[model samples]
Target: MSQEVRTVEQQTPSNRESAQRMALRPVFMPPADIYETKDSIVVLTEMPGVSSEGVDISLERRVLTIRGHSASQDHSGYQRVYNEYTDGDYERVFTLSENIDRDRIEATLKDGVLQLVLPKAEAAKARKIELKSS
Candidate 1:
């Protein structure tokens, strides 16, 4: 049996323009999942070989950014015949809504995975109130 390899299309100028517009929407990059509950938003991102100290998280103008880099380990003392994963920088951004409380956002890293908890603002949170008769 024989198998064939496929190549993906390269990014062109027109595609780049479209990408810019699409970037503003809620997005998830490779190895990442985002979910929103009634109370908060959760983001789980896989960042292999990246440490808590090396990860950078920032929020600006309702846009959240995550950046990290990984370097090749010193394999001089060992030998490897097979290698597949690439060692490079990783970056992702999210367009947060006004419902999120930027001041209360928190993030944690464990075992090369990053988890972010974005709580909704008090005013933005949905609530039910009792109505009184006049």
Candidate 2:
């Protein structure tokens, strides 16, 4: 599979110097899956080396954002060692719709995985109506 790295410079909001100051870009996300049911939308994301308390989730104005910082290693007594992967943080954002019930969003983290459950608004849910002949 092909991979893409989006630097802070590339995703700069508007200003120039502020973009430079935000140069510490987060690493690519491991993987994610989203599914919708009759009552709610479920989102699952894979995030290794991250604790439940370390992850942060927020929903504002129909926008959902997830940001997390992984635990760093303490290399104090090691003389010389080989490393393959670098530990870093993860951040991802998603735009929600009016159908979502912003007040009832719930999130949970377990076993290096994050799961979000977003319930749909009552008016947006599908329902059946009955009619009688007059």
Candidate 3:
């Protein structure tokens, strides 16, 4: 084939221009389960059809954003008669608290699930205060 694969960056712009163009596919806000452990806050986002290489996570100021894109399978010779599964992209944003250790944050994607580990800052960690005898 002489054509090259087109990435999301080349096709879709981050900023949505409502008046100028129509969306090619639907954009979904993936469902996330957020919980806190002793040392970290974990977030599990479910984004079907998305892979580790296709996902991007960024933290700016106090906001965290997740963007994922899944390439549609090519149907060169076959024509779609009845379509059930939806082909779309995923996006979500979160506001981080002061207690989160931004520098130590980590993320991983496996089997279409995005896992984010936000470590707690030292100041916010639970530490028992020891009593001293006078």
Considering every candidate listed, which one attains the maximal TM-score? 3
TM-scores, all candidates, are 0.69, 0.73, 0.75
Candidate 1 Cα errors over 4 Å, as ranges: 1-29
**Per-residue lDDT of model 3, residues 10-39, tens digit only:** 233356642122267776778888777777
- How would you encode candidate 1's per-residue C-alpha lDDT over 1-134 as one tens digit per residue? 11111222223212353356345432224367777777787878788877777677877766666765554554897887777765654567766665568888989988888999988778867678889989
* Candidate that beats the other on TM-score, 1 or 2, i.e. the better one: 2
Q: Output candidate 3 Cα RMSD.
A: 11.1
How do the residues 1-134 of candidate 2 rate in per-residue lDDT, one tens digit apiece?
11121222223223353344346544545566777777888888888888987788877666666766788765788754777766766666666554578788888888988999988889877777778779
Better of 1 and 2 by lDDT: 2
**Model 1 residue 41 lDDT?**
78
RMSD of each: 11.3, 6.6, 11.1
Q: Give the deviation of candidate 2 from the true structure as CA RMSD.
A: 6.6
Among all windows of 10 consecutive residues in model 1, the one with the lowest summed lDDT is 1-10
Q: Record all residue pairs in model 3 with backbone atoms less than 3 Å apart, i.e. clashing.
A: none
Each prediction's total of clashing residue pairs, residues at least 3 apart in sequence or on different chains, is 0, 0, 0
Q: On a 0 to 1 TM-score scale, where does candidate 3 land against the true structure?
A: 0.75
